[model samples]
Structures are given as structure tokens and as C-alpha cells.
Target: MQTNHDHSDVTVRRDGHIAIVELARPPYNYFDETLIGHLVAVFEQLDDDASCRAIVLASQGKAFCAGADFSGGPTDPQMPRRLYRHAVRLFATRKPIVAAVHGPAIGGGAGLALVADFRVTCEAARFAVNFNRLGIHPGFGLSVTLPRLVGPQQAAMLLFTGKRIDGRKAVEIGLADVLAPDGEVLAHAVALAHDIAASAPLALMSTRATLRQGLADAVLAAVDHEASEQEWQVRTADFAEGVAATAARREAVFTGK
Candidate 1:
């Protein structure tokens, strides 16, 4: 069965061993500064609780997240620092995070999907790393994670071109672990969480740790890369192009500044 939870712009429901964090911003769930703190707060709450071993991030919207809330103007100066802090916490949480991608996961939203321990996506889901299109450098450990997933070559193509891949392709490319019907991604992620929850907790946590040791370095390295890139972009003319296009809801034409 389903349960309803009401938070400011997010809803969190916990039942037995699993918790679901729903991005309830309709039409688009692109995170704002407040919502980012909400994300960190919910995850922190889950981290402290022994009963909640699994989390599924889902959304009730046309998009899983379009990226950071570009509609608000410029990116937060403190966001990179905060993003890295939260990423470190997520890595060390030991609890498994599962993402149920219902629609477009673009830019930082791509980072959110893969930030989870496991990911499931809808057949209609679209994934893109459009930081280049946005005239911003990547954040959320993408410099390290993208190369690990699609290899540096394919990752370069996607990052530079800002092209989107469908869920079927995402699964085939090893980006999505499971593919479900458009509205059925939450069910699949929940099922996966239940399966993980049924297993021995200590054993699962140990395995999760073993797999994440390498990521620790990557996370730090990505923070550096994203910082340098964003610092440079803040001084560029092309960044203006990206911001204008995004605000106008049109295509960005970056001149490679």
C-alpha cells in the first residue's frame, strides 16, 4: 500500500525498514536552496535511525529534477561547499540509497540519481549531464563518477555535447540498474529496497563500505574539479549564454570560453 506524507516541498514516508523520500514539487522538482537542506536533513535523520536501512528517492512531478533551481537566478556560492559536505555524509551513511527516476534527471539531477546506492528508472526517463549547456562546471562528483560509469571517452561525449539518453539506453550503458514502466519506477525501487532490507544488515553494510572506498577519493577529486571549473565559468562570457538560454527556455549556444 501507499502512504502520504507532507513536508514543505518534500514528503517522507517510513514503513518498517524502508523509507521513501518524495520530491513533491510538481511539474518540476529541481531543488532550491531550501530543498537541498531538506534533502540533507532527511538523509541525516535516516542515517541516525537503525530501523531505516533503505531509502528510495522518488518524485511526483514531470521531472525527477531538472537540475539545481536555475529558475531562481545564479547558483549558490555556498552550494558547492554544502554539496560536497552532504556527499561525504551520504558516502559514510552506510544505509543504502535507491533512486526511482520517473522523468528527466538533467544536470545536477543526474548527480542525484547516481548518488544513490542503486538506481531504477522509468522507460520514459531521460538522463543528461547538461552542465556544459548550463555554462557551469559539473558538481556532485561527476568528474570522477561519470568516467567510472561510461568510461572517460563516452563520458566526455555526453558531458561536452549535453545529449540526453533514454532509460533503455541508460540501462544498457550501465547507468540504470533497473527499468520499469513510466509510473512504475517507485514500485521497482521499493522492491529492490525490500530485497536489500531482507538480507543481513551488517553483511550488506560491509559490502557497501568495500565498494565505496574508491569513491571517497573520487568524491574529493570531483569537488576540486567542479570548484575550479565553476570558478572559471563565473568569469566567462559563455556562462552568460547558458544562463540566458535556460531562463528563456531555449537552447544555449556556448562559445567555449
Candidate 2:
């Protein structure tokens, strides 16, 4: 195993042809611009490394990622715009990725997992797109990826209700590719990555590119529309109520004012 770069928010280590890229934040692993930037850098580096053919995107925290840190720190209105710029780069990466989702992946976090080529999850994992519940349009290119994975009808159900589903249900719905035992999510993800890595590297890249043709471009376009919707929604009275209610752990009573 070769240990390459270790940053504050992410760590990149290579085992044979599979690179294990782990998010370092503990507990919830709430994302910010710094974390996203670090991830983009790591993925880009691994793309160029001939020794790394595939990746397992895992997290150290209890939750794979609970989404953005909306607990109020930066007041910058352009923050999501900046974050999506980095996120789009993730979709452009050439190597296949398998995400190990052992816990909650909510809102944009669910979007992050979709960036992977496949997701390996356990029953303990929860996946949701809670943007509508927060009175905002979904971002992180989920507007495109989610529907592409699970069809528009199921995607609409998930987006509108913001309901969380367990890993087994996610697999049944095609949101996750593999269902693993509770503690073996990461191992299962790495095993999947290894399977991809064992293939002929050049052919694998070519085949993967052919399979995901235009996906990055579609995600880029979708994010533009998503950001525009979110901008207006952020100004709504219901947005504030949604965030507050979420923090308070209560059902949000949104008035479409």
C-alpha cells in the first residue's frame, strides 16, 4: 500500500490499483468549501497516477456525510456556487469510484455518494435528498444524477417527500449497487473497486467514459438551474422555518409564502 497525500479533510492511500480516498471529518462529516476542494484535488491527482486505477470513497465519521454545514457560519450567498464548481470537477474524473455508505447521507451528502460509479451500503445507512424539505432546490448535481439512477418517478418521490431509505431499500431502488453487512461497507466498496481495477486499465477507462458519456456536462447544466432555484428559495420565509425546524428536530410547517 502506498500512502500519498494526507490533507486535513481527506486522505489518499493506494492499495495496489485501488485508491482509498477517505473523508477525515468525524461524526457527521458536514461539508464545506475546503472539504470539497480537498476532495477534488485528491481525485484529480489520483486520475493522473498510473498506479491508481479505481477508488473507494469512504468516510471516517459515523455518517458518510450529513450534507452542508447549514448551522450558520459563512453568510456568503455565492458559497453554493463556489462549492458546485468543485463538485462538477468530481464528475469529470476518469476512474471508477465505489462509495462506502455506512450511515446517514442526507441532502447534498446523498449527491456526493452519487458521484461514485457504484455505492456499497449496509442496512444502517440512510440516504435522503432533503433539499425540498429545507425549502430549497437540490444541488450537487442531484437534479440530474438522482433521476438518472432511479428514474424520474422514484426520484420525484424522494425529492418531494425527503424521506430517508435504508441501504437495502436503496439497493432495491437502484440507488445503491451493493448491499453489505453492517461493519463491512468499506470492505465491500473496496472489493468492488478492486474488481474494476483488475480489468485492463485502458479499456476500463474507455468503457467507463463511454458509459458515462455527457454525464459531467449534464451535471454542470443541472447545477446552474439548481443554483438559480436555490437562490430564490433561500430568500423565502419557509426556508428559514425549514432550517430552524430541522435543527430543532421537529416537523417543519412550511407555508408557501
Candidate 3:
């Protein structure tokens, strides 16, 4: 098959019924537009392949994903299209993809983790939708998925407050299904995928499909809310305060604008 990805930073290898895709941006696998498109295409192909029984999502880095590359100066004209392309993978894929998370999965990072069918986080992992801290709105259907995992009340608190918490807390809130030792996340996910591979493929497919029917549309609606809330937050005094505090390494005192 012809592949459409930058394998230098990401790699895919298949062994029997297990397929492993590793995000390889070292130090932090911060996603860019190119990377997002590549991943969407990869997941699309995996969903179509009959030989592939299960997938393990792992990363080679200190942080699974630190979110988007924020070092570049703000305001990219292609931000939405780029972001939505990434969102497409999270929403459209039909296969069972399990994420093995370590360190910080913040901003877009958390979205990537949430899209997986199952997630295994190490003791050191942290999850957050931190666009409020960045003075940007959340993207990637988090408005729906976060709430679905932890319920509306908790979701609102996480979003409005921009809270980030460790892996155990993530599992406590239903964001992670398994917790493992540091650096052992991938091996654990692969083991789980092996177990999933033992199940009847058709049955697994049907079960997942039946459960996911309205999920895409619902998440799209939540993405709209993320944009609205994010836009408003970006315009508030809180945004400036957050940004300044982040730069100065201090806690922000939000006025609830």
C-alpha cells in the first residue's frame, strides 16, 4: 500500500493481528497541520484494512503530545482546516485504537487521547484541555467527549477552569481505562490490543458501530460550543491574565468574565 505520512516522525508496523502506530516527535510530539493530515489518512487506512485486527497508539517522547506547536507566533490562517482535519480522525475512524499515554496530554493532546477506544496512562501522565490557558478556544470535539466521559458538571469545571490533572485522576474521572508503570504504557496497550484481537472481528465492529452512531454529530455540536466559549474566554481579561501568568510562571486569578 502507498503510505501518505512522514515516517521520520511517525511509524506504523504490523505484527499478525496487531498494528502499532507510534508518534515519534521527540521531547514532545507536538502536532502540526502536516502531522494531523498524515494521522487521519493512517487511521482511515487502518479502518479499511481487513488484515489489521487491532491498533496500539504509542509515542516516542517525554510527553505523548504537548499539543500543537505554540512556539510559532499566533494567527495561522489555516488553523481551522488544519484542526478540523485532525478532528476528522478522532470522529471518523471505525477501528479500535487504543492510546498509551505518558506525561502531558494537554490541549490538542487531550483530544487525541480521548478519541481512542481505550486509553492506558502512566502514573506521570496529565490530561487537560488547556486552550483557555493559551487564550484560544478548544478544538476537536472535546466539549462532547469530555462531558461524556466525566459528565457535564465535571466537564464544565475542567473547561471553564482549565484544570490539568494526573493520570490517576484521569482514570478516576473515566478518562483512562488502565493505569500502568511509567514507560510501560505501550507494552500494556499492545497486550490489551492482543486480547481485543482475539475477539470476533465482525462482532467487535458491530458493537462499536452500534454504540457510535450519534456520537459524531453530538461531538460536532460540542465543538461549536468549544468555539463559542473559547472565543469569549479569549476576549476576556482572564485571557490576558492567563497568558501573562503562564509567561511569568504564576497562577492566574480569573475574574469569571
- What does candidate 3's lDDT look like per residue over 155-190, in tens digits? 888877778889998898888999999878888999
Clash totals, every prediction: 0, 0, 0
Which model scores highest in TM-score?
A: 2
Assess every candidate by TM-score: 0.90, 0.97, 0.87
lDDT (C-alpha) at residue 251 in model 1: 84
Model 3 residue 225 CA deviation (Å) reads 4.8
lDDT of 2 at 44: 95
- Candidate 2 local lDDT, residue 211: 98
lDDT of 1 by residue, 1-257 (tens): 35655467878887679999988887778775567667777888877888888889888879998877766556656666666656655555668889999899988788877778878997799999988887877887888877877789888988998899999998888888898987889999999999999988778878888987778667877777787678667567787778889789898787877
Question: CA lDDT of each candidate?
Answer: 0.80, 0.92, 0.78
| Model 2 worst lDDT window (10 residues) | 70-79
Winner on lDDT between 1 and 3 is 1
- Backbone clashes, candidate 3: 0
Candidate 3: regions farther than 4 A off: 1-6, 224-248, 252-257
lDDT of 2 by residue, 93-157 (tens): 99999999999999999999999999999999999999999888899999899999999999999
The count of backbone overlaps in candidate 2 is 0
Q: Please rank every candidate by TM-score, starting with the best.
A: 2, 1, 3
Worst 10-residue stretch by lDDT in candidate 3? 72-81
